[model samples]
Target: MNFPRSIRWKLQLWYGGLLLLLLAGFGFTAYQLESARQLRHIDEELQQRLPMLVDSQRPIPGDRDRRQFRLSTRDALLFDQTGNESFYYVVWLKHGEPVTRSTTAPEDVPQPKAGDPPNRLRGDVRESFLFPGPGDCVLVGRSIAPDLAGLRQFAWWLCAVGVTVFAAGLAGGGWLIIKALRPIQTISAAAQSIATGDLSQRIQTQDTESELGQLATVLNTTFARLEASFSRQSRFTADAAHELRTPLAVILLQSQNGLAADHLTEEQREAFLATQRAAQRMRRLIESLLTLARLDSGELSDNRAPCELNRVAEETVRLLQPLAAEHGASLTTELAPAHCVGNADELAQVVTNLVGNALVHNRSGVSVHVKVLIEDQHAVLTVRDTGQGIAPADISHLFERFYRVEKARTTAGGHTGLGLAITQAIVTAHGGMIVAESRVGEGTVMTVRLPLALRGADST
Candidate 1:
């Protein structure tokens, strides 16, 4: 059987089962002890009155009927004629023949059987003690109807109390299980937030002595260190990119001047041009790095405004048309009013990079389609290309910094491998998401969904 993987249910089952067993054992033991004690008490009473019953067997003095009696108009305590006691006895002769018996004695009690016990129950009678003497043997006993009824009621009471206690125990156990797992739930929630790029989340430390409390303390320390490490890395990248800008600009200027020299041979001109191209590529890489660092720091969060996604897609297509022509790729569009709130320039970059990627990385005659539409409350942008598709393993890492499906740092088109990563960061900043779908030899589709701007909402 496949049970749910829930610790709460498992603990409840074990705890409840154990408690039920304990209550059943206790109630059973108590009931058996009480029943035996009642029977023993009744037997003791019967034994104490057996000799009196023997003495009361003689006929009363001056009685005309000649029937045995202990006294004339005796107290009902002897045979229960005046009260509710049901005591009775039967006397027998030495030869096992019946002699006399009390008025309340049962007529069905036959002669002493071979296996008759000294103290026994006959029919409804609880206890009948045999008192054997020189001339007579008496059987003293009483009916146990009232005792049986009381015991039956007691059994029901025990059942009722046991059921109540068991139910209460199960409820209490379930509550305790939930309480015990509360810290784990808190930890999971905090960890999920951290996973979603919020490294500032920390588990609350309410009980340091517990095991889970200690674990929480360790996780908090680890998260703090992680936050600090990421902060340093971001600062370093931004600083390094900023510091390289002037040097790269100087190198580019020097190479451009050298290439424009009047006395330069053909080979020298090519060399200078190559140097200039290299410097330009380095500058673009540095710019991408700076952009990533800014995105990491959420610098463009305040630059958001309401914009039409259709306008952005149409303009981006127009801007990239020449490049698409150069690569022999077809560009298509189905524009709709897809209003969203984000930095228009960043969202445009997102479109430009996706379309440019399709154009640069695919074979000639591949078609690239740009779409802008709305689905519910989201502005949807899809850039689909009939180009060589990405591998499944590489698709997951497409947004990772400096990762490329081609696995090379430099491409003929000078891709710095940060374009898609930047696009993802920009989309995330806009409170949006992007997805890539592809199969080998079947082309790729890049889909972006941004929160739609509400009607009449103004740009910030």
Candidate 2:
């Protein structure tokens, strides 16, 4: 039927069908009851009239006169002992023969047909009764037509009122259903607006304790997160372009200068080697940028298995121990067993960056400390170094790509300045966190925390 899409129409259809069924049931019950009552009333009326007829037409036992009995009756019929037609239906019989006669009845008065009641007939609005006589009983009947018309009228009015009430109830119920669903409709529209790139759009809350209100609150929180992510991506793109251009320009200039030179001295060759080192640093910086891009795009790893944090720390310290010796510093580890879900190579990269950052920055016999411990349902790995700690002002931006506090460190080792930034991205991709703690002259401590795997998970 192409029914309405609105909740109002749906509710009406549901309750309206029920109302119709209830009304039909009531009508059926009423019809049966009224029909039974009418039939009973007709039967009682016939019973009352039958007795009066019996008294009015009573005849003497031996009279045998059909006219005498027939004229005395007003609206009745009589039969003799042997079955026959009669009037007012009164009949008389001769002594020992089959005989029948009527003296005072209408010609059209029905006579007993073969296999029919001898003196009674039933009709739509009347019932007839028969009484036995030695020609001494009669049949009496009364019309019940008047009550039928009244009952039909009452039924028509009842049906009309029932239908009207049902329609009213359907309308009232539909209104209530639409009112209840209105908030859902509003929330849907608001969601559509948000999907169309309107990040600032928010659903209005009416009832804080209701489910819809909670849904609106959740949507608002999700929008806030999406906005922050968008802002970070935009900033990353701008910052990466600016940082990469400087090193590329320097490398290009160094190549051009070397190609134009002739009869170069040993010092000139050494300078050229330094230029190559700068180009290598630029290459590394570009690679780190690619890694961060992959991490942010969620394309990093397909397999994550439980890894021993203690083993990762030992390996990271071993790789950087040479650099520490070069700098007249010691690399050390205070490893403890802890398990996490991660890509091993990526976790190794995070540990290497932290300890490398410490060794490069500290020249005063620095000691690198690595530790594994359980904290707040997570496996924690820490790298602390005895180095010239970061100023409070520079701590916040230390992990930003190409953000350096000292230009002298950048020149000496051609530091790409993306080390800690790469570390942060790796840790984040593994569903972990990295944070730095430093004081101006004491040292720097970097902590990475990862979710710990349960017992069975570690079996893999």
lDDT of 1 at 181: 87
- Per-residue lDDT for 368-431 in model 1, tens only? 9999989978999999998778888888898898888874122678889899999998988898
Error of 2 at 3 (Å): 52
lDDT of 2: 0.69
Error of 1 at 386 (Å): 4.9
**Candidate 1 positional error at 195, Å:** 2.5
lDDT by residue (18-122, candidate 2, tens digit) is 888998899889988988887676556556655555554544677646423333434433322222212123232323222323343333444332344432444
- What is the number of residue pairs that collide in model 1? 0
lDDT minimum window of 10 residues, candidate 1: 64-73
TM-score per model over all chains:
0.75, 0.46
Q: How does candidate 1 fare on TM-score?
A: 0.75
Model 2 error, position 193 (Å): 20
- Say what the RMSD of model 2 is: 18.6
lDDT by candidate, in order shown:
0.83, 0.69
